[model samples]
Target chain A: MIDKILSKYPFPESVKLEIKEELEKLNLSADKIKALVDRCYKAYTQNLMEPEEAAGIVAAQSIGEPGTQMTMRTFHYAGVAELNVTLGLPRLIEILDARKTPSTPMMTIKLLPEYAKDREKAKEIANKIEATYLKDIAEIEADIKNMKIIIKPDRKMMDVKELKMDVLKKKIEKSLKVDVFEEDEKLIIQVEPSYKKLIDIFEKLKDLVVAGIKEIRRVIIRKEGDEYVLYTEGSNLKKVIKVPGVDFTRTLTNDVWEIYEVLGIEAARNAIIKEALETLEEQGLEVDPRHIMLVADVMTVDGELRQIGRHGVAGEKQSILARAAFEMTVNNLLEAAIKGEIDYLRGITENIIVGQPIKLGTGDIEVTYKFGGKR
Target chain B: MKVRLQDHILVPKHEILSKDKAEELLKLLGITREQLPKIKTSDPIVKEIGAKPGDIVKITRKSLTAGESLFYRLVVD
Candidate 1:
């Protein structure tokens, strides 16, 4: 019924959808809906861009002006000392740069209903997701005279991490290729009788990943409302989303490139907008998200996440002059000369450099009829 | 349970346009099919939707300003 009413409006599908939702709640009659839609159509058309308008310049100014106010800092988590998220201007730059891996890549993982509601289940998921090193749960002491490395598991930390002695022993034996056996309620690793081997085993054992997902260094489970949510220090979206009890749809990583690799370009575009908006919002600056979206669209329009700099968008401009003007001026000009490259002078920057009116507004109208054929 | 990339919130809805509709879109935009933004045939979404090369996929993106916006991408090798 809504589609039928909206089909006749002739407005863009976007406009029709919004109006349809508003109409659904009011339970309005057909005539009332038509009158309301007519008003909305008028507003939408009025908001539409004029032909040859320079939206790019407007978007740049909107975002750039507020970008000047952002602070340079990484937000530190007071409760979880190990986690520090890149925020403010640095983060904004990182997002626009389309960095392959964010400086401090992290994920906010939401669990399924069964896991989220129970603290124990949430902890189990966290243990399964976080990488647990031997150093995290045990102390390794090399008895120099005896040429043996003693692995003493802290029972309390073991209990908290839910790591059993047998599991720890097996992981140690497999990685270190040493004999690990129970000794006086402690796990003892017997290395070669050589002094060098004992020291080597001790060092290797400290860094060994005994449990959980290897990429995620830490997973902090925090109570948000009635449910528990996990915040991870390192991000591995491809693996985390597959883990049982994880609400994959809701799991999000700060790294946009990972999203592109796993979910495709559209998700990466959304990630770019989301990450940028979050960085800006964190700094208490409320620039319009549309400005960020414009940037995101350009970066991902080619189905590849590209940085806005010389190495990506600006460097790939059709006009040689625009590319040369952006950066590596001498090199770009030299290369273009060597290649006999032509400058179409199509873009705003290049046209401005040549002292010609840019291809925007009146300059864009090359063949407008002269009124009354005036001289 | 298996997960589909299309089911993600950020993915939006993707549908392969009919040949006639694709030509109509090209004519309306006054651009050739090659001029449309390209999505790789290997793209996870393209693979999921089973769009072949030369197919035009319509993407319905949920927007902040507009309630939703329609985008078209040419599937390319």
Candidate 2:
């Protein structure tokens, strides 16, 4: 689908050929160029970078001197790093073309003894040991065990000790279920039974510190009168909402959208109704925008607000009498009434004929029969 | 085949020929493959005619500016 859209766009063949040649000169494959283009496209659509920024990077590599290779390399490296984080190693592993099967192939082990003399003697001892130990251990493996570990860092000469303590703490955390604490000149670790196997795994992974994986942050917006109030926990709402045209007044309150925008939608919906109600009271006249929110929510899908035109809001019911009278007199009368005019004589007469209390859109509330029932 | 030569340039009977004829002409000429420029799959000119890889494309060479020559690509399949 994306290819189809790109096809319509008129990129000059000469330019494309030049780009291809440039890529060839750099020893980059067509696939790599495509991947870079895909990253640029994603960044462009996500509003992360301008099209010019993507184009500048592409053009610079294509026409600029070899000295600019460093900049190009940096751009590609940044793109790949982001891509790796977005599609984590586990996902990439699953999609790897080399992996035909889901399960990894097991390594076969062959043990050799040190010497011929010791080999025969070791075999006999191993056979006897395996017969007794392996049989009992295999049978007892069905039992489950629980264990815990706590870790503490050292104080006094803290700076030097801190580095060593962190390394040790990470090692313990990786290998076992452990908690760490900082104390004077020592680090304490508490460990559990299941963590025993992980001790070696952590030792290996200690050097591999994964960086650049970003946690998605959300923003919340609350409707206050004619404007939206934005907030987020642990974030400076005052500073963030300073975007031009956005109004921010801090008071004790919550709105679903505001919460959703700041802390994610699920948290906003799960907000306690009681707490919301109390907050609404505290911030008077700022009714838990939830009332309008509920109406709007029911009328919308995926949280997008649709406009309520002259015909009334979508997915809402109109009265039978209103619907019937809509074509003839009601439309004009409603328009006039909206303009603040009242014809009491016509209203009472219509009420008597319709055999119902006529609802008027204008003036003071007083029911008076000013005309006979014949229209 | 008796080929007519006008002013030392080869001239064929047909004014325009199909892809088969064009390929045959290129083969008849002593020109190497690299002399002919490659067209990319993503090229808009290739897309305009809905051509894919391995398809023969014909373009007219013209000079628009005083010193700049541009290739105006026509039909492709």
Candidate 3:
């Protein structure tokens, strides 16, 4: 019956092979296995087959013979039914047909506290203490030990406020229990041992202030000769000179100058050159913006402004598009103005034809045109 | 010739037995607990229905080749 049932279903060849091997190991005759398969096949078609039905057939046929102790366990649970088969007989066959194996290499690490003497035990204790307590020491080492003090007055005065500085220093010392020292223009406070955490807090505050200032201010860059320049609008030359690494000699300052006084001379020159091109583009010209910038950089001598074009510094490498495009843009703008004038005249003519009084002058005006053969 | 007859034990077929009753039944059959394998807590079917430990799971076995067979109900906690 089981064999007939197995034949009706399209069981995979692997599963069929497994069943055949199990039957052979159980010493069951081919005819007996065929008869069991036929019975299972009949049950499946009749809808009388259950999960355990298949399991029990496999179990009884395989384990009923001698030396075969297979067990089929079935479970009905809240979720779904399940069947499990234990191959005790096949396991015994494997054990009889098995081979021996060898071991492999390994390593281990062990602490030697048990074998330690007095000094070694003390050293181990200290190491353990450091491991547990000194986890944050390395991270705290980067914070500044001294506070950086900055002072700026709302209004400028010839005399410095020495008393105010002394009082401020005293107040900070009293509140934080830290030593305050005055350098040339700044006050530095040494961080106390108890307030080491404040070092990181203060550093973070400084970073935030600096970032805020940078965000509020608009700094632009330009190219001058072989270098770049940095400049901020409406800033004094002295303010620009204060920036480190600047070459002050090459910097120019006229009423309408394009020189950068900050950082290296090359940087200043670049800023001026970039600004010159931007100025030209702002005039609604069609010059390739990059060409104007490059020409400005090459034309400027030692950061001094110089004109660039056919008769100027870049005459040898003049571009026809640069000149033609500039001319065409100017002409187009002029044409637009003339069209506007024509539209104005047409509007006046339409108003007159409709017999409306054309508002010409604000005050009383003389009648220049003959209306109804003049009065 | 006179024949002696033994009284048959009456069993309720419709009464569903709990895990404790099943254990009592197994005791009557002279079977040890080790003879029955346990259902693991991590079994997919048990977890799918949210069955916890100490819950009884019943199974019915019907085989065409060997006819009706006995099965075990697991205590899945």
Best by TM-score: 1
lDDT of 2 by residue, A41-103 (tens): 465457533422333234324322322222211111111122111122221222211122212
Off by over 4 Å in 1: A1-5, A12-14, A17-39, A76-83, A145-147, A164-166, A176-198, A368-375
Query: How do the residues B1-77 of candidate 3 rate in per-residue lDDT, one tens digit apiece?
Result: 21111000111011134768768867876876444434334443334434455554443322222233344434333
- Model-by-model lDDT, in order? 0.86, 0.32, 0.35
Q: Candidate 2: lDDT over CA atoms?
A: 0.32
DockQ of each: 0.63, 0.01, 0.00
TM-score of 1: 0.87
> Alpha carbon lDDT of residue A219, candidate 1?
86
Best by lDDT: 1
Q: TM-score order of candidates, best first?
A: 1, 3, 2
Order the candidates by lDDT, highest first — what do you get? 1, 3, 2
Ten consecutive residues with minimal summed lDDT in candidate 2 chain A?
A: A210-219
